[model samples]
Target: MPDRLAPLTEALLAAAQKAGAEAADAMAADGRAVSVDVRGGALEQAERAEGTEIGLRVLIGRRQACVSASDTSARTIAEMAERAVAMAREAPEDPTVGLADPAEVARIWNLSALDLADPAAEPGAAALEDDARRAEAAALAVRGISQCQAASASYSRQRIFLAASNGFAGGYTRTSRSTSAVAIAGEGLGMERDWAAESRTYQSDLPSPEEIGALAGRRAAERLGARKPKTGAWPVVYDERIASGLIGHLLAAINGASVVRGSSWLRDAMGAQVLPKGLSIFENPHRPRISSSRPFDAEGLATAPRDIVRDGVLKSWTLDLGTARKLGLRSTASATRGPSSPPSPSISNIALTQGDRSREQLLETMGTGLLVTAMIGSSVNPTTGDYSRGASGFWVENGQIAHPVNECTLAGNLRDMLMRITPANDARAHLSHVVPSLLVEGLTLAGE
Candidate 1:
C-alpha cells in the first residue's frame, strides 16, 4: 500500500511545483471497509466500500489552499494542484501557515514497533452477517429482553502516506474490527434501551458476539422501570463508560485553537491549579496498537509523551506547528488532519490518573447520590465553564444502588467540579481516553 500511495503523493507534489507554488505537501489514503447489520434474526444491511483519495496543499508565501479528489488520474491531479495554487494566490496570508523545518521533521520512526495493522485476512460478508445474527440471537435469548433492536459487525483497513517538499515522506497502515448489539427491555411506553460494543486493532482480540450481546441484554434489563430521582444538591458519580466526557471537556478547554480565539475557560489558567492536588492528565502518542497512537504528526514532526496537567497544575496546551508558532511555544506534535483540510491541534491518547478505590467503594463514599451512566443534550458555556446535561442511571442510597433513574439534569461549573472529583480505578485500559469513573460532590440535580 505504501508503494501504491507513494506515487500518487509524488505526482501531487510534482504538479504543485509545476503549478507555480512556492511549497507544497501531499497526502494520499487508500481504505476498504465491510459492515453487516442484523435485525429480527435476518440480514438487514450489508455494505462494502473501497476508495483511494488524494489531497494537495499548495503554499504561495503565507497563503495556502488545499484541494482533494477521489479520482487519481494524472489530469485530475494536475487540475487539483493548479486549482489549489490559484486559490492560494487569492487567499488571505497568515504568517503561521507553512510546513515544518527540515531539521524539525521526523526522519525515522518505528512503524514495526507500532504494530498498527493486523495480519489476518479480511472477514467476508457472510461471516460478518453471521456474527451480527448471532449477537442479535444472544440478545433476544435474555429472559426479559423484549427485542433486539440491532446488531452489527464491521472491519476496516486504511493506509495513508504523507509527503512534502520539505523533504519529509512517511506512511503507515491500520486495521480495526468491531462487534456491537442494542437491546430493549419492555414494550411501548415502558421500553428502555441499552447497548454494548467493543473494537480492537486485531480481530482476535475482539470479544465474542454472544458476550457482547448478553451484556447489552443485561444492561437493558437493569434499566426497566426507571424513574426520576429526588431533586436536590447531591453528589454524582459518572460511570466509567461516560466519565471520559468529563475529562474531554477539560481537554477542549485547553485546546490551542479555543485559547487563540479567546473562547476557552482555561485560557488564563496556564500553570494554575485546575484539578485536585494528586491528579494529572498525561498524553502518550506511542503506545503500541492503540488506534490513536501515531509515530509522526500531520506536520511530519515526531510525537512523544507529555503531561497536560501535572499534580493538578495546567502544564501544557495542545499545539500544532501553527498554533505553537502563534503562541511562541514549541510544537507538541499534536497536529491532526484529514485529506481535505490543513492540520489542527488535537490530542491523541490521554490517561487521567487513576485512584486507589473501586467504583463501588467510591459510591459507598458518596452514600446517597445519582450514579450517572448516560447523558443527553449538553449546555456548556466554554467561556464560563458552566456545565449542564440531561442524565439517566441508577440512584444510590446507603452506599448501594437503590433503583434505576431517568430524566434528570446535573448542573455545575466545570472548574469547581474538576477540583472536587474523586476518581475510581475502573477505567478500561484499551481505550484512547483512559479516564476512570469520577465522583463529583455537591452538584445541583433537577428531578422529580
Candidate 2:
C-alpha cells in the first residue's frame, strides 16, 4: 500500500471507536495527466491535470457513513474521518451492508502487472503534443480536405490505496495514453468530416502517427457527398469499433449488481440460448495489451478468465465481494472501482470469439446494408434490453460500398438483435469489446 494510506486508515478506525462505531476504512489516490488537442493544423488545447483525493468510511453499529476530500493535509484526512464517524452515529441502520468479512478479503498479489510507466504511457508532454500536431497537419493535407475538427494526444498516471479494518489492504498504479485524428472533406456544396481514435494502456501500442493521419484523411474524404438512404428495414453491419461498443452493453446485463436489482434484462435468461450456437464471450483479466487487465478486482480478489456467455448460452455473472455474499455465489474476480472508492462489479477484458472469415467476405454477403462505423451516444435500457442510438456510416450495395450517410438513427432491442445476428467470419481483438464486424438481418433505419 502507498505510505500515505496507513495513517488515514488508522485515523478512521480511531474516530469510529470514539463514536462507538464497530468498523471503518479509508482509501486515497493521487495522479497526474497531460493532454493536447489540435484543430486545422493549429494548437487548440494543451493542458495538464494533477489531483489527489482521499475518502473515509465509518460504521457505527449497523449504520455507515462516508466522506471524501481533495485536500491531502493531515488535518483534512483526520477531519474527514471524524465527520464520517459522526455521520454514521446519526444515520439509519442497515443490517445488510458493511465491510468485507476478514476471511473473504483476498490477499493483495503482485502489483508489477499493473505498471504502465513505459515510454508509451509516460511519453513526455512535448512528445504527446507533437503526435497531435503531426496527425492534424496530415489530415488538413488530405486531398479535397478542408480542415480538421480535432486531433488529440493524451497520457495519464495514477495510483490508489484501499485499506479497511478487516485486515484488507491493497493498492495499484497504472498509466493510459491515447491519440486521435479528424478531418473534413468535399466540395463547397457537399462536405463531410470524420474521425479516428486509438487508445492503449501502453504508449507503444498506439498506431503510428502517419497511419493515424492517413486513415482520418481517407475516412473524411470517403464521406464527401454523403446522403441519406431510403428509409426502410435493412441489414446492419457493425464495424470492428461498433461491435466493441455492443459488448459494453453485454457487460451491464450480465453483471450481478444489475441482476440483483431486478433491473438486468438477463435477470431470468440464465442457461438460455442467448447467442448463436458457436458464439462465446469471455472476460479475461489477463489479456496482454488491455489497460483494464488486472490480476484481481477492486475488492482485492484474484481475477481469472470468466465466461459470461458460452456456446450461445448464458454462463456467469460478474460480481464483487459484497454482491457475492448476498447472492450466495462465488465471485469471478470482477470487482472494479471508480477513483478510490469501494468495490463495484466490472469485467477486465472482453474477448469475443471470432468466426473464420474476413471483414471483406462479410461485406460481400451483406449485398446491400448499412455499415455503422461510429456511435454518437448510448441509449440502452439494460433492464429491458431496449436500445436506440444515433449513428453514421456508409451504405453497402452490390457487394461494395456505395455512398456515405449521416444523421441517421438505428433502433432495435438487443434481444432481437442477438437473435437476428448473422455472424461474420471476421473478429479481431482490438478496442475494448474485442468484437468483429457484425451483420444483423433485420432492423429499422430512420433518416431524412
How well is each residue in 1-448 modelled by candidate 1, as lDDT tens digits? 4489999999999999999999999999999999999999888999999999998999999999999999999999999999999999999999999999999999988987888899999999999999999899889999789999999999999999999999999999999999999999998888999999999998998999999999999999999999999999999999999999999999999989998889999999999999999999999988888899899999999999999999999999999989898899989999988888999999999999999999999999999999999999999999999999999999999999999999999999999999999999999998999999999999999999
lDDT of 2 by residue, 1-448 (tens): 4576556556655655665658877677788999998776667789999888777777777787778888867677667767777787788866655766677776856556545344443677789889998888878778977877888999888877776778877776777788889788876768787887888777776787777877899999988777876678888888876787776777788888898888998889889978888888887776655677776565556677777899988888888766776677777778766533556787777777776767777788888989988787878898899889888899889768899888888888998888666556566564556777788877888887
Evaluate residue 44 in candidate 1 and report its C-alpha lDDT on the 0 to 100 scale: 91
RMSD values for the candidates in order, in angstroms, are: 0.8, 2.5
Top-scoring candidate (TM-score): 1
Using lDDT as the measure, the top candidate is: 1
lDDT of each: 0.95, 0.76
Clashing pairs counted in every model: 0, 3
TM-score of 2: 0.91
CA deviation > 4 Å runs, candidate 1: none
Off by over 4 Å in 2: 5-19, 113-115, 119-121, 187-189, 339-342, 425-430
